[model samples]
Target: MRRKARRRRRRRMRRRRRRRRMRRSRMRRKRRRRRMRRKRRRRRLNWRLEKRRRMRSRWQQRKMMRIMKRWRRKRRRRLRKRRRRISMMRRRGEDNEEWENEEEEEKNEEEA
Candidate 1:
């Protein structure tokens, strides 16, 4: 009876040790898998952020072009008005001292 009890106790201890080792290996495997999944998700987030930055930069470039075009058009219009005023003044001999025309000579065309 004493030998049978000793054998039974040894068997139970071996079983408990085996179970503990199995649980530890299983937990280690699960932890490694979780870490790998987190790394993949981080890579995906980085790609998405880069894509958003490229899109935003493109939009900013387009907006700047629009503003530049509007400013150029306004400058061109002002230059045209200034040139017209200068031409009219030159045709009236306002800038020339010897090219003066009589007022009665400019009124002959209105009578015709």
Candidate 2:
């Protein structure tokens, strides 16, 4: 009877050890899987962020180009108006020396 009892106790201890080891291994696997999932999620978010940044940059570039073209058109219109005014003044027999000086000034400004 004593030997039987001792054998039973040994068997129970071995079973408990096996269960504990299995639980630990399962916990380790769960932790690894969770970490992998987090990494994948972060990578996906990073890709989205980069894509948005690229789109935003492209939009800004297009906006700047549009603004610059509008400004150039306005400048051309103003220059054309100035030329019309000078031509009318010339036909009216006004002193054209002032207009010649203005043209020189405009040329210097454009060169700069």
Candidate 3:
């Protein structure tokens, strides 16, 4: 009877140790899984933010290009109008004095 009791006590102790070890391993696995999940979520959010930034930059670039094109077109129109006026003055037999006066008036207007 003494030998039997000793054997039973040893078996119970072994089983309790194994149970504790299994619980510890399960907790470790759960913590590792939670950490992986958090990392994935953060990576996804960062990717989305980067995509939005790129898209916004592209839109701004397009808007600037459009504005520049419009400004160039207006400059071209103004130059054509000036050339037409100069030709008309020359056809009317106007001298360099009138042309110089017009240039001074334009300069004053620009300064104002």
Candidate 4:
């Protein structure tokens, strides 16, 4: 009777241990799966943000180029006008000192 009781107790303890190990393994698997899912979502969001940033940079570059082109065209027109005015003044035999003073005033106005 004593030997039979001991054998039965050992069998019950072994069964309980097996159940505990199985439960622990299941919990670990669930935790790992959740972590992987979160990581994947974060990566996707980062990729979307990167794409938007690249698009914005491209748009800004194009706008800057357009502005530079317009500025160059205006400068060219202003230079042509100045050359014509100087030539006409020369033909009219205007005083050189007066023209120089006018040029200095124009430069000051532009600086202001």
> TM-score for every candidate vs. truth?
0.39, 0.44, 0.42, 0.39
Q: Can you tell me which runs of candidate 1 are displaced by over 4 Å? A: 46-112
| lDDT tens per residue, model 4, 1-112 | 9999999999999999999999999999999999999999998879745555565577776776677689879876876687578778989998687667767765765674
Q: What are the per-residue Cα lDDT tens digits for candidate 1 across 1-112?
A: 9999999999999999999999999999999999999999998879745555565577776776677689879866765665566567788768753223433433453363
Two-way lDDT contest, 2 vs 3, winner: 2
What lDDT does the true structure give each of the candidates? 0.72, 0.82, 0.79, 0.79
On lDDT, the candidate that comes out on top is 2
Worst 10-residue lDDT window, candidate 4: 47-56
Instruction: Sort all candidates by TM-score, best to worst.
Output: 2, 3, 4, 1
Q: What's model 3's TM-score?
A: 0.42
Q: RMSD of candidate 1 to the true fold?
A: 25.7
Please give, for residues 1-112, the per-residue lDDT of candidate 3 as tens digits: 9999999999999999999999999999999999999999998879745555565577776776677689879866775676678778899888667776766766665564
lDDT digits (tens) for residues 1-112 of candidate 2: 9999999999999999999999999999999999999999998879745555565577776776677689889877877777788888889989778887877776675574
TM-score between candidate 1 and the true structure? 0.39
The TM-score of candidate 2 is 0.44
User: Is 3 or 4 the stronger prediction by TM-score?
Assistant: 3
Between candidates 1 and 4, the TM-score winner = 4
The numbered model that scores best in TM-score is 2
Q: Mark the regions of model 2 whose C-alpha exceeds 4 Å error after superposition.
A: 1-56
